[model samples]
Target: MYLWIITGVVLIVSFIFNKDKTIQGLKKAWKQLYGIGSLLVLVLICVAIALNFINEDLITQTLSGGNRYIGFLSAVVIGSIAMMPGFIAFPLAGILRQNNVPFMVVSAFTTTLMMVGILTFPFEKKYLGFKVALIRNFICFTICIVVALVTGLIYREIF
Candidate 1:
């Protein structure tokens, strides 16, 4: 890929100019990668477990044709809690959509999937204080529901 090529060139240039610094940088990067990689693995494992437990039938049965408010609330809560990467979440969302999941539900889930992170609350609270973090997440959560509902309505009216 282009990015791989670019990274290789940059790394070669770095090695040419300063081997020691480049080695130190690589070591630091490796440590960071190790930590992040472990976290990613854990997240993926949890996602897989959840996906196995929550099948298409379950989603269709629960999230479909129910009270819109209930569907929206369920989507928001599930989205806020799921901490998978967008790469994983997007495809999972597509599967939900294909299984006749409401676009509104998908929108809410995907939006909050990116915006809210219950798992990351501790980190947010530590840096931003609990009140600010809570307020921000609450606002984002409200926006996700509004956006999903509006989008669903528009889609229905237009098409």
Candidate 2:
């Protein structure tokens, strides 16, 4: 892919200029990757299993029915409740889309998955204060809905 080529070029250039720094950076990156890799694999495995149990028709009916609004709202609620990093959320979004979920619902789900933190609210409130945490979550939730609507319009999912 283009991104891989670009990254390889940049990495080679970095190594040519400063091998030590490049090696250090790679080590740090590897450490982070190693830490997250296991969790990522587990999550993917769980998703695969869940997908087998879930009916694609049900998802299409519930999440792809843009005009209903129920599907959109359901996605938002599910997204808000679930917490995961962007790396994980993206692949999940792709799976959802492949399963016939519309762009609107996938965007809403991924946006809220990354932005809204209902499960982490207590920790956020402790560090950021209840008011700030509450406001941030509210704003993020509203923004995700707008994003979903715009995506729906773009995809002609909403009539």
Q: Candidate 2 residues 20-115, lDDT tens each?
A: 999999999998788667656766666566556443444445666545467678788777866666776677668778767778888887788788
Assess each prediction's global lDDT (C-alpha) against the native.
Answer: 0.78, 0.77
Best by TM-score: 1
Score every model by TM-score.
Answer: 0.64, 0.58
Runs in model 2 deviating more than 4 A are 1-68
Tell me the alpha-carbon RMSD of every candidate: 4.3, 7.1
